[model samples]
Target: MITAVVGMAMAASGCSAPGPDPGGATATSPEPGKSISNAGETASWELLNAAEITPESTVLRLGVTRIECASGITGTVLEPEIQCDGEQIVIRTSVETPEPGDYSCPGNNMVPITVHLQSPVGQRQLFDAACLDAETLATAFCVDGGVRWRP
Candidate 1:
């Protein structure tokens, strides 16, 4: 849940679904601080929360608040970038936006992004890189684990 503060006022609502790919989405486990594959240049979004569909499943539905910046443009969620930092599986979100121009985006709401991982998560800890920043980690509305989640 988010409260009004500053210039940001967010609405919460969403659904989880597989990516547009028919064969199912694929993810990469790049080293920390390295860029994982994504579309165009993107911005990072912190996870409001996350849940493993099943204990053995590698798929995750990452809770996020989407900021819709244009009326005609859709699919604001870019593919998620995955990373492995020691004993943790770092999940990062890349937000896609159209080129700057006259636009109207009246809604900012929550969306659960579904991602597919190559390996079963098992016991690995989950972390959100966007929330891991030293400056924001403490103040960021991250999960109870302080940017990390345990199943």
Candidate 2:
């Protein structure tokens, strides 16, 4: 009887031993400045700042927040000129305006314009416009054929 009881206790204790880890060693977090990669993953871009456009110039602030490219590249900020291959963004330094006598609208009547940004994921509008007027200051940014606007 004693031997049987001892055997049962040993069996019960063995059942309580730790099992295999579900996450495994690969689940551990990477060290600082290091990264992990998996196959067939895609990269993503993140806009850091709202785009700002003026009568004389247009500006966009953007950065890459996630990357899973074939080249093993990481997320980064793209140069202003190289953004989206120039297809999605357009900037003009000088704007042509009508002559003083061409329109009755006052020069001080500056209309605020808001631009929208489009991407593979979704659409987002630029920063809120200071002012907006449809006739003269109507400008928009169409990316990937999508429109972006907050309100």
Candidate 3:
């Protein structure tokens, strides 16, 4: 009787499904530093900094914050120009604008930036972050993933 009860308990516990894949919680790109294939499409994003920000630039800093993937998605920031040294994605900005007519600014200062990134799809669902205005039209999210937007 005791052996039968133990076997039944073990079976019941084993029948439960696996909780979740922590890896899938965040959206990341391919391992080789190239476009990632997901949801039947290739995905990538451009990191525009404040120093490089021009009058026509649409991107602006949203304050420094660490973002985590909520669930059911994963992605990465595909920044080829900036080098990711060690575990850091370094962003450099100078007080002086990179070019003339960049913006009407008094102080051009250098700022270092690092991002805790997931795929666009992961970020969209995790945070209320998204591209504002007409940029939305060009962005897309996987139906299964949260909300991946291109900014």
Query: What tens digits encode model 1's per-residue C-alpha lDDT throughout 113-137?
Result: 5555655555556666555444334
Candidate 1, residue 46: lDDT = 42
**Residues 61-151, candidate 3, lDDT per residue (tens digit)?**
3222112221212122222122121121222111111222333323222222333222111111121122221232243421222122221
TM-score winner, 1 or 2: 1
Q: Clashing residue pairs in candidate 1, if any?
A: none
Q: Model 1 segments beyond 4 Å from truth?
A: 1-55, 66-75, 98-107, 143-148
TM per candidate: 0.51, 0.20, 0.16
Structural RMSD, model 2: 27.8
Expressed as tens digits, the lDDT of each residue in 102-143 for candidate 2 is 323221211122222222211212221111112112322212
Candidate 2 overall lDDT versus native? 0.22
Highest-scoring model, lDDT: 1
Going through the candidates in the order shown, the clash numbers are: 0, 2, 14
Query: In model 3, where do residues sit more than 4 Å from their true spots?
Result: 1-97, 101-124, 127-130, 139-146, 149-151
Residue 8 alpha-carbon offset, candidate 2, angstroms: 76
Show the colliding residue pairs in model 2: 112-131, 112-132
- Ordered from best to worst TM-score, the candidate numbers read 1, 2, 3
All models: lDDT?
0.46, 0.22, 0.23
Comparing 2 and 3 by lDDT, which wins?
3
Which consecutive 10 residues in model 3 have the weakest lDDT in total?
Answer: 1-10
